[model samples]
Target: MVVTNIAFIPARGGSKRLPRKNILPFLGKPIIGHTVLAALQTQLFDRVVVSTEDTEIAAVVSQWDVEVDQRSHALAGDSVSVVEVCLDFLDRTYKNRLPDTMVVLYATAPLRRAEDIQSVMNLLDEDCHFAMAVSVCHWPVHQVLKNHGDHVVPVFPELIHSKRSQWDRYYLDNGSTYAVHVDAFQREKTFYGHRLKIHEMPRARSIDIDTVEDFEWARYQAERMLL
Candidate 1:
C-alpha cells in the first residue's frame, strides 16, 4: 500500500525575543519561506502546509503557492506547544483523511536542507514511530560546568579529570525536523515514542534561530554555504 506524507510548519506570530521571527529575512525571502521551499523541494510530502495565526506569515506562505493551515488564536500563543499546533492542524484540515506520516519542520530552522528532511522522514518506517534531527554536542560533555550558589562546578565531577573518550557522547535535538507516524503521534501526543530514531546532522546545519544573535549567525552560515 502507498503511504501519504504531509509537511507541517508551525509559526506563531508572537515572539518575545525577536519580533516577527518567523518572517525575518534570511537570504532573500522570509525564514519560514526557506523551510516551505525546502519541504517542497524534498518531493516527499503530498502536501506542505504552514500553520500560523499571522496574516503576514500567511501571505508569505501564499507566495510559495502552498496551503496555509490557519491556526486559532487559542492555540497560537507563546505558551502553546508545537505538538498542540500539529494536533489542531490535523483535526481541522484532515479530520476524515489523515496522512500516514507527518513531517513537522520549524520555520526558524533556516539552515535545514531538503536532504536532511528526507533523511529524517525515511527513518520513520513500519517499526519506527518518530524520527528527529539531532546534532552531536560540539564540546566535551566531561568539561561541562554547572553554576552553583557561590561558584561553578563541573556537571560531572567524576569525569572532570577524565578523558573525553571516557564520557559518553551526547546529542541534542536541532529542532529542524521531526517525522512521525500520524496515528502514533495522535495516540501519544508527542514525537517521543518507543521506536524513535535519530538522524544525526552536522553542527553547521543545526542552527535554530531564536534571538537576533542566532539569526545573524544563521545568516552568516547560510550565506557561507551558498558560496
Candidate 2:
C-alpha cells in the first residue's frame, strides 16, 4: 500500500572493524533484527524497508515482514556516502511522487527503543526538516590541543579554564534514528538538510556497535536491561 511515511534502513554487508556487523548476532538475534523490530513496533512507518547489496544480509532480513531493496554494488563500497544509498531507493521506489517523510535507522544501534524512534519522528515539523537522535556529550570539548612541531598549545585558551556553566553544551549524533522531509532531503542530497532538531537519548541506549569491543559493551548493556 502507498504511504506517506517510510522507514529506510541502510545495512551494507562490508565492515573492516567488524565483518558482517550489520547482521552480527546480538542478544540471540541479528543486530539488524533488533532495529527492524523496533521500527515495526513504533507503528510510525507506513513502510519499513532494509536496503542492502548482500544476498546474505538480504536473506537474513527476509525473515521479517519488511521490504528489502537489493541495492547495487555502486552504492555498497566503504567510501560511498549513505546518502547515495538512500537517494537510490527513493528515486527508484517513489519516482517523482515521494513520501512526506522518511526515517533512516542504522542497523548497528540495536539498543534504541521504539519510543525514542517516535520521539525523533515527532520532532519533524514545518520549522524543522531534519530530526535525529542525539546523546548529551559527557566530556564536552571546551578546548582543543594543537601540536606545532615540538610542543602542543591550547587551541582555545580562553575556554581552558571556563566553568561548566560558562562552557557551551554539546550533543552528538547517536547514529540511531533520523527523520527528514523527503523534499528537503532530495533538495540537499543529505539528511542534514534545513532546520535540524534533536531528540536527546540516554547514553545507555545510544551504543553504535562498530568493533568487537563495542559489540561486547552493547551486549553487556542489553543484558543488564533484561535484568
Candidate 3:
C-alpha cells in the first residue's frame, strides 16, 4: 500500500484556560493519546510526527511508535503561530524533503474519527489547496451582539425580523481538523484560502475540547458510543 506522504500532530503545552490540557485524562486516556491513536489507526500517512516543546509531552509521545520532534521555546511561545511550528519542524528535521501534503490534527479533538482523517486524505487533489473536516451548524451569527461605545446592539438587524431557523445558511468551522498541501500552506500559512475544500463530517464527530465542561461531555459521548 502506498501511504500518503504527510501527517503531523501539534500539541503545545501552554494552554492558559486548561492547564496541561494536552495530557488531561479523557475517556480513560490522555487527550493527546486519542489523537495519536486515531492517526495511527488510519495508517494512511507515511509518517506521523508529534511536535512539542515540553519535555513531558515528548516523553509521553516517545512511548508511541511515532517520531517526536522537540520544538524550541521560540517557536512554541503563546504568540507563535501554528504555521511557524510546522514550518520550523519540517525545516529543521526533514530539510528539503517535505511531504506532498500534511494534516494538522488537534489533540483536543479526541472525538475525531479515523474515517474523518481518511475522508480528508481521500479528497485531496491538485486543484484543492486545502481540505478540512467540518460539521454544518445553525449558529445565530446574525443575533450576535456588538458593543458600541455605550450600548450593545444587534450585529444584524435583518435577523431580528427573520424568526425561522431554516432561513439561516449553514455555518462551518467546527475546529476539529484541517488538511493542507505543504506547498500551498507555505505560501499562505492558512487553510481557508481561495481554493480550500470541505470534507463534511457528522456532527457527532465534531466535538472540540475547549473547556472542562466540553471535556466531560466528550467523555460521555465516547462512552455512549462505545456501549
Ranking by lDDT: 2, 1, 3
Model 2: per-residue Cα lDDT over 1-227, one tens digit each:
56899999999988889999998878889999999999999988889999998999999989988999989988999899888888888888886578999999999999999999999999998889999999998884876689988999888888898887887779989999999999999899877777889999989889999999989998998888881
> Local error of candidate 1 at 61, Å?
1.1
The per-residue C-alpha lDDT of model 3 at residue 6 equals 63
Model 1 misplacement above 4 A: 1-3, 142-161
In model 2, residue pairs whose N, Cα or C atoms come closer than 3 Å (at least 3 residues apart or on different chains), thus clashing, are none
Distance from true location, Cα of 109 in model 2, Å? 0.4
Best of the candidates, lDDT: 2
Full ranking by TM-score: 2, 1, 3
Instruction: Please write out the lDDT profile of model 1 over residues 59-131, one tens digit for every residue.
Output: 8789885888888999988789999888878887775667899999999998888999999998977899999
Superposition error at 225 for model 1 (Å): 1.9
Candidate 1 TM-score to native: 0.91
Overall lDDT per candidate, in order of appearance? 0.88, 0.90, 0.80
Show pairs that collide, candidate 1: none
Q: Who wins the TM-score comparison? A: 2
Model 3, runs deviating above 4 Å: 1-4, 163-168
Compute each candidate's TM-score over C-alphas.
Answer: 0.91, 0.94, 0.90
Distance (Å) between predicted and true CA of 152, model 1?
Answer: 6.5
Please give the RMSD to the true structure for each candidate, in Å.
2.3, 1.7, 2.4
